[model samples]
Target chain A: MELTRRDALAALAAVGATVGGGVLAGRYDPPRADAASDAGSGSAAEPTLSTDLLDLLDAAAEVVYPSGVDGRRTFVETYVLGRTENQPAYREGLQEAAAQLDAVARDWRGQPYADLDADVRDKLLRDLGVETAEPVADGTITERIRFYVVNDLLFAFYSSPTGGRLVGIENPIGHPGGIESYQRASMSPSSAERSGGTNER
Target chain B: MSADGGSGGSDGGVGDGIDRTPSPSADVCVVGSGPAGALVAHRLADEGANVVVLEAGPRFEFSERTAQQEQHIRPGMEDPWEMGGPRDAYSTEGRHYPLNAARVKGVGGSTLHWQGMVMRLHERDFEMQTRYGVGTDWPIDYDDLRPYYADAERAFGVAGAMDNPYAPPREEPFPLPAFPPSYSDSLFAEACERLEIDMHSVPNARNSEPYDDRAPCLGYGTCKPVCPSGAKYTAESHVAKAEAAGARVIDRVPVQRLEHDDAGETIEAAVYATPDGTEHRQTAGQFVLACGGVENARLLLLSASEQHPDGLANSSGAVGRFFMDHLFAGAGGRLDEPTRQNHVGFNTSETHQFYDDTEPVEGLKLEFLNYAGPSPVIEALGADTWGDELAEQLNESYGTHVAVGGLVEQLPDAENRITLDPDRRDDHGNPVPHVEWSLGERTERAIRRANEIQHAILGELGASIEWTVGPESTGPAYHQMGTTRMGSDPGQSVVDADCRTHDLSNLWVVGSSVFPTGGAMNPTLTIAALSLRTAEALSASLSDP
Candidate 1:
């Protein structure tokens, strides 16, 4: 529904292709369970998250998802770099977006965004209306910068195949199916009142 | 030719035929490995008839790529992103559609992506001319095909709801009980009852339990485009059965034409082309065309010769005429609250209360869309929400989404036909099928009624309108039927009641192509039943004194 990592991974799969009796696709197959579990393991050769722009984005990610900051950063770097692998034009655009994000952070905190205190960082996001959920477009430069960080960067981490596991969807796109069966409580008022995931609306 | 050539232990073929010549002879040769072809082949081979099945596409050896299948063919996604195959290679010479016809080219055929909706056309659907005075009557009635339907259900391992007076009359119960419906199904049933409508479990050719050595549905919720689990029935299961029963199935060999006798009343051999530009002829006592509607008609049209200047089976000029597809339509809207419907075994229930209502030839089944969820909504609307707030919103609204719709029956018109493209060619250098079709006045009228009903049903479920889609964008090409229609008379039909072409005693047409009218039901089950019936007739004819 949210164009999750499954949808992106789906783009790489073709029916005719096979390798050693295994399908050529499955960026998240069961064999890759080890890779997903260790999403934080990065090497020096990975240049995607090396930019200062990514550093600031990673700081924001750290505040939002403090428990798995390294994993989130790794997942984001991998997804972004994977998407921009073929298009130099799009890659450059992302780099430019990072520079713009830095500019916005400088104006807001009187310093580079990543260097701001945690309180200042939180207040800056709240003040810029970055906490809003609906997609915003045709906006101010600051508004666009806020969107890039909160929506693009944060979403890429949580929406990745590993990120889906962080939530509750066990068989997100690219992953092997066969989760143990269990009934989920409905999002009705009675269930919502009894449990927590669903709201009373 | 004897099925075993009288040496019947296990190797069931003419042992020296392969060593002698390239032409292989069989008791029956079938074109198209879809439902009709696979079922007929399986049944005939089991009946001790040597059968050869020629499929025009690859067998899709990559079975484990569920995501690719999900993206390419799952029945109702927002214009499924295809994996690019010959299935989606045909051209439309006539109308505008938001999506191309969801055709699956392989041994399993379109069934590889079907939703497993196994429903029977009502009794009145077979006698539309006598009942509603709208469409041509089927050569045979429901009673004639009823036994075959039951047989097909058992053969296909269908899980169905039985003992309902509302369901089509049957002598026996379902092979397996119905798959449990989702939360939305219950809500929709309540709404339907409140609105004074009857809803029933959709009879589907899917396994609710493990049977036939195949695993039950794992509830992956991808029934269209592809069923990752074997829970849902694809024609490949029958193809495998046919092969196991000694039917020789050759993939990637597109049949070119039928070699007819000088009188043009008997098919002697079927010539086909392999992928490597090699041509071979299979001499058979009988030939069955189960290549779906368009391809069947297209093949017949391609077999034009001096004796039959128009086409091989075009004496009635009906080989490619009367092309029809179920006029598909639906409506979707948001509910007042989350319905807890999305993400459970999707496409679990349907209601046929209004089937055979306005037009005897037409019927409509209402489906409670389990595919409705936040992700589809976001993707459909291109809502680029990415932050934590959006994620929370998605989790909150995951299940509340709802929609309802169904197939509306279409009246057959000769103008809506499949003719060969004069210039365009496929892999074998044969003219590709060119279809000219659109929703007729009757079908559009039916859609309006269906659209209104959907609104009332959703309204009864406390739905508040949020971007509703109606039948305007509905693509009817998904259910290709009625191209090579069967009838009682030779002057007006391509095939007889037994599904044999009137012009050629040994030539037969099966599948939806033989339907005189499409009755707003998914036609795979009916196609299977008819093919089985035809296989029986062919076997009987072959063994005649």
Candidate 2:
């Protein structure tokens, strides 16, 4: 089905279970350039992502976190910029990531930045992530972006409507049970051992 | 020093009429503004008392400080301990059960970042000394505090299953119904029942539905930071309520030394410092020292005068003794089936069998904790030190596993104490409280047994045990308590059963500092109940006079 933004959000909310009956529909929208510009005023000019890179990031996010019934993607465009400037290490990491991608792309097609097909892009990205590229050094420019993207994707997904629902993020305030035996067990050694017999199921 | 015309001049005329002095004066002076202090001030002000709560730390607000949150979540700033601002946090003296908890100084106190788990202590907890013979009994039993617990529950708008057969009896139903369990909780519940371990949903103080004008929890997963939605109950909420009630809460003022008259044994005034370092005095008809456990005792120790050399109200020499904290440990294993519910919410379902279990420890209760899925940093820490095994485990368990942990009671030990540092002082030049703690053999035994129980429970549930140990890399459980205990005899305790200092009739101490023993469960609910009881007593005293 072709999902409208409303349908997408509803599906996402159903998936996340975060939007209860009280959620005001259409209240949230992607921030306008005015708001974004205001928030980023003091920082250097905002860096523009090449359409190819954006496509690559979206494709990667889909593979890592497949779209749920909500049909909405988990990659928030803001995350790319948010981490880049507010996070210095992330900026350097992104540049190094671009370099790695270049290396992978070269090995396959000998073409530079702008000319790559969807199939070539997917193969190059997947190979780099799997076994082709050498392991990135810890905290290096290349390593940081890879970590940041993965972490951001995971965080956004889990916290999002669909991800939240799939994982079961309940309303903490209305939760019905008293102190759980498991929680109590987790806190004590003797009880933990006694209760250890039950966790396997 | 004879004040109030009472006749008891023993101890070198310390209470002689010769030193009688009028009580300090203040429009509204609150002693300890933890949950109780905040509530009382709010209620009294709502009744129109000019309330001024005395806290030892600078006034703090979650939104006002961004440094800690910014640094912790920022890509490279991933240090676990580096989340909060320096002055905004407290550290334990060593790796012990009395682990130092992060308490906020500004408006809300520790509630600003609390998990908002508000469960009433079972009725048996009040009579532990009598029933279990392993600990001292409370001056007032659960029955006495039941009404107050209800009031606090109403005030905070707790959500939980009132019908839970295992729960304590309540005169009134919860202000709100229970919140739904997350997916993870349901899975755990199913797994637990299969193994015959009892598990239930967790009760929380966060709003299930809007109560008292507060919004419902937004589920931001950033509760450890300030709740932007203000759904979590903090002293700040009470501060606002108290202000509306006509109470005045002066922020950024830290109480230093409390002055008591040597002759009459009555508090004269409290000496304190403002954010700017200027010294000031607040006198009231009565004075309460609600400045948390460590700070409360420190104030008394700092207020030593010729009349009471050991420190004001320290005749029994037990002012800074009997420290206690819950001992924490856990055993968890990988389940054969993917518990795909791991990421549903923060903790939801938990085991409760250990709470009233007759086996093992006769007197202690055990509480289970379902900490949300492991953070990436924690996941990395657990990964194999040398191989891609760490990465593989991280991938497998990242969002598809569930683990249960434990919170065990650490019985109080007199030798475990909080005392003044010989050569250390805070930024205000005030002596800082130092804690000296060592677990008694009973606690060690409890840990050994609990670990075994956890292993068995998980194994029965068809899970492979991965890690089983006590607090990782952190010393002692951080729920610090038992510094200033209450008892009937002045020879053995600092405060009386009423939480009043035996030596100084008008000087009352509140907070967990007055707890003689630290139970295994979280102390916030009990502490709130006790604070309310004290406030009731104070209110009566004020009205009668």
Candidate 3:
């Protein structure tokens, strides 16, 4: 969790993304380092996420994929690290997002992203630089951040065999674990509430 | 000598030009290693005929394919394993169908990504013109293919009930028992029964009980993208048998064109190119094309020679004409409670009460889906606003996703055909197959009626309709067929009763390309049946001569 120039360069080397010539500067801005170090996945340590960026990403994951009863893991951290280091397009956009987040935090309320209140944080994102006057379903710079940052984490979660299990799909297609039968709730109203199941609408 | 050692004489184009050393290849040269090609090659090889299968793409091991599927199974990713290879640039202009499925050029062919729904083309499907006074009749009828269909069921280890009251009569019982329907399927079946519709369990290539060396379906619900348990039958299974039976398989070798003799009546050799640009000539007594619907037609078009300027086997100018595909249309809805269990089973239920095989509506087969729907819904919603509120909605909706859809039969029109793409070319500079997939009045009417029926059915069930539009309404099912249609008359079709091309004696076409009139059903089983029939005929002729 130490934000050293050596760590930055090493992390950059690992993912092999183009290190923008604008900065080689190491900035700490760390969030709860003890929690990150204790996280189970090993790939978390190899990526160089500055404490500020990590804090910003943690908040982003929470807002993007609100935790269910199982609660969210530090999944966005892994996803961010995976894309920024491995994929060039994502890394460039995320780096731009990080810079944009910093600019937004500086003007509105002079505080770091993690220090900002949840409502303020949501508002900042809701009012992030948008392109069209009308609402856009796709193809905007702000929309690109959601695609790069938020959607990647969702994919990283749901595509896995474990993700399918969290929602009663014993095995998704890629999972080697085979399902013998479908454990579906009954479609009839009499048995509809079998497992805390109510009407969908 | 090879397993199929024979003093195979070079038939043509020997001393003219295009100089290349003729490799003493198998007795039969099978282009494409998919289901049709592999079945023919396997049967021929087992019959002691030297068979060499030329695969346009590399052979995929199950383990490697599993890895590819694992990565692609994640949302928003398309498995590269399910993609076509370099020989297909000229075949990718799919305006009506899925562009990615132009043709899967690998060893398993397109079956690698198929749903394993092995159903027969209806008896009336072969007699389209005879019964409905529309389209062209197949040279052979269902009776001719009945035995071959049974044989194919054994070969693919198809599982289903033999005595279904709804389905067309079969000569023998199914090889394996049918898998039980999921709760969603059962509900759909119940609804169908109440409506007085003849809903039945669909025949499947995947095992319900382990029959072939392959394992049984373990209900992974990911049939099309990839079947992780190897339960679903893919072309690789047949290719393996063909190889074990002494048929040689050369993967990553694309057959550029067929060389004919000075007489232009027989195929002399198959010229192909390797990955590193090494060219080789394979001489054989006969050539069979199983390059799928679009590619098979394109290959013939690409093989234009000095003698046959209109392209080889185009004496009738019908090689790449009369392209046909089933138009799919329907709607989906959410049930009262969680119904995401639809994805739990295979394509378990099909409704055939709509099928009439007449002029107005011959191809109306309904499919009740059994899977969670919000995977697509959540994906479309994206990560924005998808976190908290929508996540809760998704949790509820994902489990309650329900849908019903069906395939509408489309008649063959000369205008709706596959021609060489004048603007685009493949990596080898060959023109891709340009699909003119404009639907006719019949198909348009069918779709409108299907939407109404589906809308009514969902309304009757008291469920909210969520998704709809397909085939004529939206996109084609990628079930491309009839690019090189078959018939008794040589003037109207590309191939004959045995799928042999009219202009060329030793040339044959297999797979859905030779389908004279595609029924409103999955064409894989019929393709298998026709291929097996052709293999028997080819074997008999070779033995007699």
- Model 3 regions lying over 4 Å from their true place: A1-47, A51-65, A68-149, A159-183, A186-201, B1-23, B70-79, B82-87, B90-99, B357-361, B376-381, B470-472
Q: Best lDDT goes to which candidate?
A: 3
TM-score of chain A, cand. 2: 0.42
Chain A vs native chain A, TM-score per candidate? 0.52, 0.42, 0.49
* Descending-lDDT candidate ranking: 3, 1, 2
DockQ for each numbered candidate: 0.08, 0.05, 0.16
How many collisions per candidate? 11, 96, 14
Task: List model 3 lDDT by residue over B364-460, tens digit each.
Answer: 8888776537553234234235456645554554666678878888788777777788787666666777777777767888877777777777776
Give stretches of model 2 more than 4 Å off.
A1-201, B1-27, B56-100, B188-196, B262-264, B341-346, B357-359, B362-372, B375-395, B470-477
Candidate 3 lDDT at A10 equals 27
Go through the candidates in order and give each one's C-alpha lDDT.
Answer: 0.66, 0.56, 0.68
TM-score of each: 0.75, 0.71, 0.78
Interface RMSD of each: 7.8, 10.3, 7.0
How large a fraction of the reference contact set does each model reproduce? Answer: 0.03, 0.01, 0.28
Better of 1 and 3 by TM-score: 3
Tens digits of lDDT, candidate 1, B357-444: 7643367777777676554222312333333444455556554678886888888898888888887776666787787777676777
